[model samples]
Target: MVRVPGAKVALSTASCYPETCTTAFEMAADLGFDGVEVMVWTDPVSQDPDALRALSDRFAMPILAIHAPCLLLTQRVWTTDPWTKLQRAREAAEKLAAPTVVVHPPFRWQREYAREFVTGLARMQDESGVVFAVENMFPWRARGREVAAYLPHWDLLELDVPATTLDLSHTAVSGSDALAVCDALGDRLAHVHLADGAGSNKDEHLVPGRGSQPCAEVLERLAARGYAGCVVLEINTRRAVNRDEREADLAEGLAFARFNLAAEAAT
Candidate 1:
């Protein structure tokens, strides 16, 4: 098997969904993941840096990245203020020695936050010495209509962020070509959320090869480009019937990532 020395395949805690963050660390370690991306959400353990550090030590799994609490459901998490949430996320990443922090654009309704998001984020990154990789989001589709849910648009290319997180599932939902976006981002692409979708209005987060996305191609491209950033498995396992099922799905995702990433060297 060919290996890309700079690249590492990490497991996102969000993939564990209903499972606790502790369970995610255990699963990542059990499945031989290079590291874990801590998705800061409702899980109390996820919010506690010391607790997360304990789990990291317990499992010997490094915290590759920290995903800020920017989801709608996480509005109250960390705090109601969006900037504060990002600040806390940066702090967490720094404490855990993670190089990057994944954040989403402000919701359209948060006019004040959106107004200063670009400049604010730049300032935060400069002060913290952390890479705030802005994640691409998709427009809200309902009743056959598209709503511009995120301010400053959902497309990363349209924005002037220093670094970005290319989420393949979001690309699938937005009907954007994954390979093209990947190429366009180039070095601005500081992180990746590796998942697949079937071009549905809903974010499918399917296994890599199970969807229409060019998942393998993207991984291969990253490998060829000598991408040192983490390729995190952010697939959804909420539908898993049991712990075994979840573990199987995670294992499959890890295998897919490693295989495709190695394709570059094999050639």
Candidate 2:
């Protein structure tokens, strides 16, 4: 096993206090994270390159990656056209000097967009220097029935995409082994959303080691595989009763990442 020397540990801006992306950067900086993953949502500053760059400078934290506005709440962000949204995300990444832009597959209802997803993604990668890391989403469960919520269903191994972002939370929700999925992904796994989840249909982004998923084991495997990627702490801290608890969670996530990716561990 070839252990990675030093995989970066970043915090996702959307991890806590969805009020503004600035809080994410501030919390990460205070917790001594290596950098941050900007999740562009309804926050106007999230979509503005100049503002994002300014925040990075102010916090002295690099923007490791940019998550495109792809969630249900961000449907009306850049433009109604999914392709346009992707293009704008790429531009933002380029301006921010972020190497990757994480995106989600279109919804099942977006037939036309889904049809061109694979090819379009490849084309975008070729045209833009930034990597378009497609994220895995969970199925929509309702009335004791399971339905494919995403265009390509949460598994990217079957897809011919160039890169992938594996989220442990999503894996747990899918009731799949985290290690098995990481093995299946191989080199295509370019980014990671470091969170844990219980075996539930709901998408719960629990902090690492707090859930049943082998979050630490997965990190060790990534190190052993010499995976050079951005590990962003993407946990949902909405349940945090106060700022102190929230800060503690973020600090724990960062420490866990550093311990697993330390140079001594790799050696």
Q: Give per-residue CA lDDT, model 1, range 177-216, as digits (tens).
A: 9999999999999999999999989998998888999999
TM-score of each: 0.97, 0.95
Per-residue lDDT, model 2, residue 76, is: 89
Judging by lDDT against the true structure, name the best candidate. 1
lDDT of 2 by residue, 83-141 (tens): 99999999999998999999998888888989999998898899988999998777778
Scored by CA lDDT, what does every candidate get? 0.93, 0.87
Q: Which residue pairs does candidate 1 place in steric collision? A: none
Mark the regions of model 2 whose C-alpha exceeds 4 Å error after superposition: 1-4, 262-267
